[model samples]
Target: MASLLLPIAAAFLLLRVILSATVIDDLRNLRPPPDFNSTIARNCHHNPSLRYCGNSRPLDEIFKFTIVASHLCNESRNPNCVESFDKIDLRGRPKIAPLYLSFDFFWKFCPLTIRSIDFSNNSLRGEFPTSVLACAQAEAIDFSHNELSGDFPVERLASMVNLTVLNLSYNHFSECKLSESLVFRRFNSSNFVHSGLIPNKQSFAVKAVFLMIGLPVMVILTVGFIAMMCFRRRNLSLETPQLRHHFTTSMLKAATSGFSSENLEEKSDGVDIYRGILRDGTHVRIEIYWSNISTEGMRKFIEECEVLVQLRHKNLVRVFGWCDDQELRAIVTKWTDRESLEMWLIERAPPLKHRLKVLAGVMEGMCYLHKSWPQVGYDLGTSSIILSENLEPLISRFEFDGRNSSAKSKFVYKHKFGVLLLEMITDRGKMGDVEAGKAGFIEHIRTSFTANWQNLLDERIMIASTTMEQARQAIEIGLACIDHSANEQLNMDWIRHILLRIYRASCHVNGSPTHGRFDGDRDKRHKHGP
Candidate 1:
């Protein structure tokens, strides 16, 4: 008995030693480092057995998702159970086929694990589940071609800060609550298609794609474009009249009346405005558009200046050149001593007939910019537009945004400005009862007036059109040019044609009277006349 016990003890000791030497350290080393943000919660399914998943050793070898799906659907015996995918390596796979994984079971396994969800054409029924809102980082949600009902749960979705696109097409959400903010409301009705929600053209997916694909390409293109522009501008600057003058600091000092306050036209955006004479004694206005801007700030301003330099039109105000020598920065433009139309309307009681003539000239200038030279609006409103010695209006101060290279036209900004013009003309030179330069004065004009043509027409101009149908046509066309929809607004080309007809008819209708008046008032009002 003693001999048998000794041999058994020896054998047990040997086995224990071998197991410790071979397996224990290997198992300790093989343990996975923890991932704190893993999709553990998403793997909860309608399965009780998967509750033990937390205890599984060699955990990487087990599929929590497959286990939950089988447990929920009671498909442990099915050959094509989600378990089939358990052994398949899914890393770096570019495509996910929806049919292979039953979405019902997929939801059961992990509802919020996905970053993108395209459940379109699923024939899924019922209201859009609020549970999906749990997916905080979801970027796109496509529920199109389904049977979803009820108003869009905007309140719930407001929490999804990163959600950029929400497609509910071919559904029944007719009276859904929506965000009225421009960022939210910019989407069109077409995104709600076939009684479903239509995606906005500026949808997150499109914007992201633009950012990811189009934006980088755009940046590359922009860099190349700006480089070429800088090269061309350098060449053009050498040939410009302002550069040819070879203006010296002393020359600028002498021209600016020693930078006197009396010569200052107006203070704007920290810029000092001075009426200057060039070295050749050519009169020109100089605006020392200065800022204590950081290096980045200066770059942005210079970029804007570069964009402005490309534009050329008679109706548009031209920047001759800029000076950035040393700590000083300045901009120069053609100076008109007559000032803006706004100043004239305020100070001088230019008669209604003369005012109409000024307005006609304004329209002519706008027509040339919008149609003839074929740049949209130069953003020329009352301030940017200058009047000549005879009160002829000229549009000025053309600006462009280099950052927005894809902006095809300035139609939207121009149409709003046109509406303001309508209000200005109709208000009979009386800007408002409010004090001049008050905030919201311009905005009040925009909002207070009705968009209807009759309501917007100036009573003064209305009297001018009486018994002159052609003048009436001119007023009608001017109103049309300011229509809110850019497509509906008349381009300068169409406006020019209309003005030609109006001119011809004016000659036929009031030609005799105008001629008679011209002959009578020739010496008093006009130096030269029929």
Candidate 2:
């Protein structure tokens, strides 16, 4: 019984194969059903896996598709039919017979709607087929193991946007007509074996070199270069910086017009900051606390100033002197007339270059504070950055960081400075009222950073698209600073350097004047802060 069953199954399979071939030949010669629906229904009944018909079921007319081979059209039976293909896929099928008609007319009038074509190992003969060009939408084409000859369409193949795979191996083809190395960058040598053509492999070799050897070396060299640059700049910035100066109470009072309310610029909860100009034409910002304050509060302020005066960078406000008289208690420093950074960001809507310059200066100031005094930073927000006459930023506040001297405290300043950076680029981020907390504000900014960076920009300022990209780096640095975990390492100096590079690029692109340095004349030039 087993031997009889084996013979019966073999006979059935052979009969099915012969019937399939006969059906295909009949399909070509005989007229198809009156419409595609009957044809698909019949095909599904015979073989469910035919084309797109799945599970032996025919689809509705809406989902029905037409496959026009262009060469196998029944002109007599379908005279009014459109010479167009909707879909076709013949994978792992039998070798194709010769075409029925010319494809020139169809190519001119109809769109070739093929997704892919596989004619590999077809035992085809003659030159490369021009009809293949008609299938412009084909993503993959296989013409390997054929007797195809003549100049291959190397130049034309490069123009196909969707064509990805091309197999021409074991073919007697001519030399590659392309001189550009990029034309065959995607293809491999095996695809053109035995043909007088070579794929451009230098790109892959170069990329491999970069990944394995060149990349690590480049990274090391880059890190060393930045370290060297930062070391030089840091030493230059700290060139024999002396301690603070002390002035008499009489001179401060004279400068502030007897500390009257008229000279007062800003009044905080327990602080009255008076803006004054010296007789020598030097402007000054005088800090004095009173009203709803105890002696301890004043003492803390003095102590904070003592720490601030010990260290100095060009970005920090220049401490001219403090008036420690018999009764008066005040800390004085060289001030800016243009007021705080908050005022400028909110009111002026400064252009990209100015904003970048401010950001770089602030980053520099923060880097110095974190590096020089690990247990220090500020907490007063954007109001802490006072602007000099040349519109340069000068950090004016300091937090002794006695409350939290952990690693978080060191990064807290970085995070705060990041917030300032976000504010610099955008105006619609209702940071305080809508997005209340630090994390909330950062989330709001993140949502605003859509594909279009232009929408979030402060439109009051004019800048080019490239400048806008630089502005994007500022926001990224801000977000990175805020989101970085305690364990994550960051390079504050490198960040500062990146910001300065952005400012310089923006300046060059926007055709703005160079950002000024804190020269000796900066002391001579008076500034009154907000």
Candidate 3:
């Protein structure tokens, strides 16, 4: 019986050994759950400076916490770094104490998975890190209440479409000249509160100071000076009758060949524009207003004449004189052989460089007018811009009557300029259909800008990488100009500067200077006539 029991025990022990071996084999074959701690541990080894809570905690939670806390906290400064991790909030966890981290160090070590960064109320000084522009996925950034200095990267920040919130107030930053793009317009004056933010305010303050000191003194001096000058002028006017150059009805009729079909260039709103040559062989265009003369109409015409006579710019058509006869009222101006922008665009497809030069010229003129005479408004449109013999753009037929017209609003000018830009790039004649309704125009541009703006570009023009970049920037500027929000519209100064930059870049791409000093033969090839 003892021998049988011993054999049974041996069999049982052998089975147990076989079962244990099989279990070990199965365990070896089956892979263990992935240990995230390995990756954390490797990163720690790679970066010796990186600190971790411990290897005891769950790997997933500790890894996420370490990534955030590593750059945010310095163990030397605050030994209780692990305790602060619990207070982390999605909105933003304000620092209880300042972090003495350089911009480069923070950005280099900060994980790309971070969605929000709040570095407010710190001493983060240095030039804005260009690396911040790479955080494409970052949504919110608060750099307010810091000692940041140098030129803020407003344009680059604006380009980040994913960025929704940005607070840059209370910083030691230099004046940031924000372009009137959708990104810059997203913030208000509140975003930028430092001195020199609004350039005009400084001049305005100086003017105010000068006015307070000099106004009374000048008023007294002017009262005495004007009285004497008025008496002398009254006597001179009575004696001389002020001989002025005026065109008579018969003279204009003769010049325009009695308003013949060949001479008639355009007739709109009871105004007939006739192309004519003067008796002295000078080419001219005669604008004859045929509407029945009303008191208001005559007053406005006189006011426009006064304003035009005072204005002199290379980009403005030279107004020779006006005809105010009882029967016919006309304005005589120098003729632009190259004709209106609308006609030139239809007849000749200019290269991007030439088109940008023309646009720059227009903006320069507009900027001048907007700055020198804020009260004066222009009737800006495609037909209103005329090209000179040298392909220079001139703003013509812009009459100011000392009244606010919708066309005079900076927003309106931006909209018109945007349409003109779109025309130049897309080869579209007019944006009448798009501008007919504001909603449709916005949606069209927004969609096209996002999906594929290249499709909208003119196929006639060859698109290189540099040229494509320029076109994309111009399209963005156009979109910003025509933004539905009035506040979003770029001021004439900003628009002019941006357009000039684009013009310079375009000229560089074409191997020319900012003024586009092309060869005589190339110039001749591009010249067109009405």
Candidate 4:
């Protein structure tokens, strides 16, 4: 009994020590109240110091905590040392909402440790206080269920690195800009439903389409109003008009159910690939943490995003937009459930006609890439080409580094395309198949093809009717492109023309459908003499 009593006494003393620090916690009535002595915050081996003090400063006797909960923070040791104050809930108290003076007090005394602040359901009115940014290290801020109005400075919000938790829903903002590269992972279209925010993609496209069609009609009806509108639009600095809405990491999590294993398709170091469905019922694949935002990296990536969004072609995969969040970075691209071209090659041994179409499409896309972004290189392997529902091959990867960066050569990309064609034409035993030699994929192709050129056509295609000769022609051109030693090598332009001819001939001979069926008369000029 004596031993047990001594242990109980020590426990009681520890409890008293914790409860005494609850002075500020009472005024706000924190929900699921924080544990000041939360063992998790003490992950660091070093002893917590008193340099910044552990007690939150009292504003006054009545409303004691106006400043910040910076006491438990020890940045040098545990980076998450201050998450105990993760959420400062001064909610449900209508009187607290209108106190701009209290907000200023928060700014002056805040030790930059707060991550979340909840002031929802306070019946707060008027503009969102600029002082809310006072929690300089804020991660989550809730201003929902209020009557706030005016512009939502989303561009300004982009500066916050870990600002993942946010809800400005049920507000009356006149304008919300979605043009910034920061895609709130969740899109949260419902959050801004009644808030009068225009999504970037529809906002720009709709306006352009409306202006093009409506302007002529409006001009004929009333020229003066048209002139006024045109002048105003030119002067208005309204979000610069983006054609696609950037998605945030939060929106992605919601779409992918917090990137659950079921939705995760691939997991690599610091990178993850997921399958997601957009609000519009579009299927997409998200590659998360694509790469770290190194020095001047965000700017370069933004440029890449701008460039990628503008590329429109049948052979290239569609990129919706990119996320530049500090915690997680990702790129969103249109996706389908179809197998990649390599899979089609290995498993189904796609027909000669399908193979020809793949080659033609890949070459066409590469040509467009060279013309559109000559400085960039097409990035891919055998598995990089995915066959769409219609059997059209789409090049799913490309990379654009800085101008001085090595990935900036049209010729190099052309050579790469040639190697791809060679790979497609042969059955290399595996997707990334290699010969018994130490020679790399490219080197093996160069030497092997030169040695036994005749048996090179994949056995799958060798038996393919009527298109076999055409397949041979494609192989010849591919060899010439990769043969750098040749004085007169095949350029992509001539290659494109020849492949187009072969595709037409193969279609005519096999009665092969165009696009899997072509237009009227079937380009009879490309047909061979019977």
Whole-model alpha-carbon lDDT for candidate 3:
0.63
Query: Residue-wise lDDT of candidate 2 within 154-255, one digit each (tens)?
Result: 667756788777777777776664574357678665666765456437766999989999999999999999999889767763653323255677887899
Ordered from best to worst lDDT, the candidate numbers read 4, 3, 2, 1
Give the whole-model CA lDDT for all candidates, comma-separated: 0.51, 0.62, 0.63, 0.63
Candidate 3 local lDDT, 107-151, one digit each (tens) = 433445556655566556676556656556677766776667777
lDDT of 3 at 457: 74
TM-score of 1: 0.41
**lDDT, model 3, position 278:** 91
Residue 461 accuracy (lDDT) in model 1 = 50
Question: If both were scored by lDDT, which would come out higher, candidate 1 or candidate 3?
Answer: 3
Native-vs-model 2 lDDT? 0.62
**What's the true lDDT of residue 73 in model 2?**
29
RMSD of each: 31.5, 31.8, 37.3, 27.3
Mind giving the per-residue lDDT tens digits that candidate 1 earns over 169-265? 6887545333422234433444457643434445657888877998788899999999998997778856663454234455566888788887787
| Alpha-carbon shift of residue 488 in model 2 (angstroms) | 3.3
In model 3, which regions exceed 4 Å deviation? 1-245, 257-262, 267-269, 401-408, 427-439, 463-466, 484-489, 517-530
Clashes, model 3: 0
